[model samples]
Target: MNRLKLISALCLLGATSAQAAPSSSGPIGPNIGYGDASNANTIYDPLANPANNALNAADTEGYRVGLGINAQTRIEIQDLEGASDYYDNQIDPLLNDVANAAQLETNLETFIANYDQGNISTISGVTVPLLIKTDSMAGGLSLDYTRQVGAAGIIIKGTGNVTPAADGTNLTINRGSAALGVTYKQLDEFALGYGFKAVTSGNSALTIGVTARYLTLLSNQNNVDLKQFIDDNATGSANFSDYVDGMDTGSSDSNLTADIGINWMADNYMIGLTGMNLTEPTFKVNNMTSTQTKYDYFSSLVPSDYKMKAQYRVSAQVYSENREWTLAGSYDLAESNDLNNNDTQWWSVGASYATNSAWYIPDVRFGLRGNLIGTEKTYTNVGLTLGFLNLDVATTTTDFSGVEDKQKDAGIMASAGVEFDF
Candidate 1:
């Protein structure tokens, strides 16, 4: 079904509805709503090299508690590629498709082909479910404490983020002076998960672990059009259940899943596999759209029924005899509906050098990967460990060579944390 129409349909055919109070913000847009974000262990960033769990598994260390804090931002801007008019004049019009109505899809495609040419990385108004979040303005500070007990571990995290009131509202956009608008979505999450080494034997050559987890929700909400925003907050006057299939309406829904991992450790080498959301649990999200009709008052929840796909990944590593140098790689095993389709199955390779405190610096690392499988750009990463502090930075560029001007084309994400041994 055409997404906008289906999004329209979500409101029309609700078996039930979930209450999600809408929020209003500046008509001009805001840089991440100041209300809050997530305290993600760099592990969840999905973009860090040092935080690669696969690498962690390959080089096992004694039990320790990793208390960390990090913040980062990544922005993707189209290079324009010599075609400025196509985006500035006709892009939003193409995106503002009428519900259940025909679209300028062909025109949009032709323009993209002429410029983007299957380069889904540049950005588009008509995108798959995965890219929807990219446009949303997001900002947050994170605080997390992790404990590693032998092959078992646990994590406790608290995060506060400033996110736009609604999905698709970017901090900055090519929309030009187009009288853009903003809607804020409240994002507050708290999670506790434990990793259990279900089995490890034969001189610790093989091991498998399962992490049971839950993310608590508290009045998670978003603002849509002016009318629904008021109705959704009418004190029990609104519900979006019947019209939606997989929407997680209001505060009455499940927010839990699990991950399983297996690793093989041999002399100087290790390879492992892990799967998240193994239970196949699915949830609903309120669909945010531009044009609103009578049905828009109903659900507008996207993926009305979706079983969040389980993600599986494979990783391997080789270590130097002296244990001072190591190399590792990460690759996803499948395409997951839970994330951007283009970002699925991304792989990264990196190398780390532990100086054994010889130079007063414990470790230094480097990583390289094709961002979105080189569909968008290339990412180069660096990591440093000085004293009790660890720092990691990742930079994105269209070309690997440093010749490209950094000012005009690049996105960056960097993180730092302090560690203590148990």
Candidate 2:
């Protein structure tokens, strides 16, 4: 089947539907939404870089609680124009013609010759229902989800050349073991972290922190089979409810993991290093048989283990002489797979201006970020702080060369929260 063509159509539809909701934002930090975590303030810093908790305790005494959500979807197509043309002129004309063997063979060949393997798509997000931090520690509850559809697969043709009935009501070829599908994963975790002030020398200090997390895993591997899906739709058995009941879901036992970080804070400068998922916790995907089997024609594609890989990062911040303006940067030391199993390593920079003594005045923040490995798209970030409330947004530039209004690289993220101090 025309896999890239199918993905192209879905991408176009997603762009149109996203207008009603907040779309992709790089990483979920209202204070540094553009991707820099090194110079985060006390409240948000602990979650961004656990070691910041110690520095924060020494600098100020306060506590805060907030909620945030970050989600994004991206589809990259090398020749969207060509793909659209194929989809319009060839694929759509015979989308449900399983009875036509000759036409199906021709279309399959066209898909292979012109596809060229430059298509990829991923949907991923993080939701923080409650995040809190005190002078000495930090803790939170968060949920994460990812959906990845593989564009690579092989088609198995029948052994004998079969001819369809003239009446056009019978099948021409047997639906063989040809397979294609997507992977879905979700995680919910509760985390508690603390940092210790190790040494104080002159106007500089050193601190180290560690966070422990308890995680629950859920997933559906090989959730879709193109052949089965199409047949269901044609036979009028593929409604939304049926689709939901078709999945063979899986869950894993609870697991524990940890993150470690260190920071060096000076009079007007700071730098930090962090390693996340230090233990690389592993989960075995288990089948939780579905209740309804109406559309459960496909079997589980493959059973595999999901492992959280360790990721390392470093950051630095420079403050203005008067302490009103701040500039900061952060970079990932090595590549790691995101929630969607896509490789990613990011480098981010940001600048902010604030008045130390004003609660009514609004603080301004701006930033730029780019992925060093996967997606490799650059984004612009902007944020505002008024009184106890913080708001932020980030997005990538649009591409006009492809289909009109199609968000080929369309991505955006928005977060808002309020805080209080004692």
Candidate 3:
């Protein structure tokens, strides 16, 4: 009965807080729509889409900008029945053997307090990307902008087994961020980019990132928060009174991480190897308390540090006189400590056809993508280009077991923009 109540509460929370937000790929190509943009559609250039491929083609003298919106809703249900029985032995010896109504209630409350914390986060924003090729430069320059607003709600109802036993715990948080980035390319083979991100909420912090494609390197840095620290230590019933002795002695840490990749391109095929987050940077939050009538409470939570070691991608394209078809696949290395991490792989096949019917539409393209994450999922997208304007839409779904227990995530994402020729 306790399990049923917990599941029901989680479902309610997930449904209420689910919202729509702008996806990462609001500009440029559809290849970056759901997966990595590097593998989307490559015509001659190894890194960019075929529409903007520059290896064997002349640099186009023009600029393009786009705007898009994306929304997602998901439901997750986990069964603790199959989890390890260590909890029964250490926390409650009689938990597993008890069958009485009162014992059942107590055990359920204890389990929920220890592990059942429901989380909901929503991110929405507007993104803009601008690309321009000048007469003097060999390649082009691109500028990116994103302004997003986010909110998160966390609920951890206290259990019947803890010292400060409480019926329910609630926290509502709001956050906002703005980011700007610029990239410069030389002869379409080498590129350099840097970005800045500013976040404001309970605390304010700044993050900076840099990317170098020729050398296959990318790095980023940012600060930490105290609320996150409290959440991390909530599971352990240790006395935090000592940790939060000084409220003015706030704790903060910085993180620095990098990625490396190698690329090889042929006439019709391309392959690449990449490693993300090679630097294992840890962010720690500390809580300190003082000894006097005066009050001070400081707390901190730190995230586990790890690196992504394996990531590879392969892509091939077949071109006709005026049309082309592309196929690609990729695999990502998984994190060990994060339960949400999964060893996921993806495959995509898409085709673009040319048209000259100026009265209706100029071009049409279609694509199909298959993903194997925690479960098997499939996505389909259709795009149209007419003169200076481009538009696209996509949908995805997942299948699992049970009716009420089954899960599905489906949404419509669209982007529209114009290109200017100098």
Query: Model-by-model lDDT, in order?
Result: 0.34, 0.52, 0.32
lDDT of 3 at 323: 25
* TM-scores for the candidates: 0.51, 0.74, 0.46
Tens digits of per-residue lDDT for model 1, 158-236? 1211111222221111111111111112122232333323344654445444444443321222223323322233323
lDDT of 3 by residue, 248-300 (tens): 13333334444344433333444444444345433332212122221111111
After superposition, candidate 1 runs with Cα above 4 Å error: 1-63, 78-204, 216-254, 288-307, 337-343, 355-359, 371-377, 398-411
Q: Which candidate wins on TM-score?
A: 2
Cα error, candidate 2, residue 406 (Å):
4.1
Candidate 3 at 181: error in angstroms? 32
Residue 302 lDDT, candidate 2, scale 0-100: 48
Candidate 2 or 3, higher TM-score?
Answer: 2
Better of 1 and 2 by TM-score: 2
Question: Cα RMSDs of all predictions?
Answer: 16.1, 6.2, 13.9
lDDT per residue (tens digit) for residues 196-220 in model 2: 6678798677878877777776655
Residue 355 lDDT, candidate 2, scale 0-100: 47
**How many steric clashes does model 3 contain?**
15
